[model samples]
Target: MAEASYPEDLLYHPEHDWTKIADGVATFGITWYAQDALGEVVFFDPPEVGSSVTAGQSYAEVESVKAVSDVFAPLSGEIVEVNTALGDTPEAINDDPYGAGWMVKVSLSEESEQESLLDRAAYVASLT
Candidate 1:
């Protein structure tokens, strides 16, 4: 599993998801806390590229040696890209939860919704 970290550059969801937004698009992934909690990742089931994702709803699932966990969308959007690499190298999620482990890229449908997400400080605090 990845070393514990809550990157200050990304926004967080209470469910342990993170978002990296830029120019109306965003990359979504489970946070460091998530992969670590799930143990070694072995599978990633992603939504299709054109599928719509709703904030606070599960858009995909990640399976670890311990259990399968739903991956929530932190904002409403249409999935534009999926990390296909994870299909063959699921261990990347455990080795690099924030980098090669990212799950999808989406064209945002509601950019303003990002304001509701937690900042790193608040997210870390919530964990305690």
Candidate 2:
């Protein structure tokens, strides 16, 4: 399992998703808390490129040793790229949820929605 971390540069959602915005694209992934609860990831089927994803919606599915969980979108956007490597080694989601475990890169559709996302401090507070 990876060490617990909530990067300061990323914005977090109450559902345990995170996004790092750069330009108009944002990279999305589940957080450490999320993967920890789900246990060792065994499968991940990502959304197709160019698919539209709405903020606060499930865009993909991840199967873990413990259970399968929906991977949520933290921002509304069109998927531009997906981490294809996860299909071969899903444990990356458990080992590095914030890095190689990142699920997708999206061309964000609604910038204003970002205002509602929490910072690392606030997200950690919400956990307790």
Candidate 3:
């Protein structure tokens, strides 16, 4: 089956995060389908801004009524910013996972890792 939902502008990870490379930084967020599957988000434990994060490593956490889930880094980088809004209004994750609900922005320490991540179509294909 073909993918019903995949943003052409974003690169994706098998872990369900999406990255939008802008400027020299990459803005990232959880995909909509992932937010839905996680249920309602109530809290986020994101990495501190300026911290170095390694790809495929646990760098953040998302908490819902049911459980807390770890968010993995899709690429190695130093976090330049985190969505402070999610701290107060975690439900924004469900309401606008791709926009205002974005989790972090990082200055990529290595550009080569981007090639290893999936494009939108591949991400959707993996979901199947």
Candidate 4:
């Protein structure tokens, strides 16, 4: 695996999830560091669109050739959409964890929750 990159535009959970907020909705995905650790992702099991997800909780699962890992929610919200494309090409997670690998979009229950997440610098420091 190569050195992982954390984008400054996103907030991060210590568990290696990233959240991109926009217009009360948040896009969620596992970080590059996470996918590298998980190995080649073989499956993505996502929650339903109408389902709720709580901050600091697992909302879905990604199975890799090495193991199955829980994908955590970085904010509390109702799921608005899931990345169905992952069902066919799970390796997109390993290839593009921040872009094509994005798992879900959510309508946030508490916008202020964003304050609790780590910035890119902090997350990179945590990795060290």
Question: What clash count goes with each model?
Answer: 0, 0, 0, 0
Q: Write the per-residue lDDT of candidate 4 for residues 19-108, one digit (tens) a residue.
A: 999999999999999998898899999899999999999999999877889999999999999999999998988888899999999999
Clashing pairs in 4: none
TM-score, one value per model: 0.97, 0.97, 0.93, 0.97
lDDT, candidate 3, at 63: 93
Question: How high is the lDDT of residue 49 in model 4?
Answer: 93
lDDT of each: 0.93, 0.94, 0.86, 0.94
What TM-score does model 1 achieve against the real structure? 0.97
User: Candidate 1 — number of clashing residue pairs?
Assistant: 0
lDDT of 3 by residue, 2-108 (tens): 12355799999889898899777999888877888888899998789989988888889999999989888888899999999898988988888778889999999
Worst 10 residues of 4 by lDDT: 1-10
Positional deviation of residue 30's Cα in model 1 after best superposition, in angstroms: 0.5
Q: Model 1: per-residue lDDT, tens digit, 49-101?
A: 99999999999999997799999999999999999999999989888888999
For candidate 4, report its TM-score. 0.97
RMSD of 1: 0.9
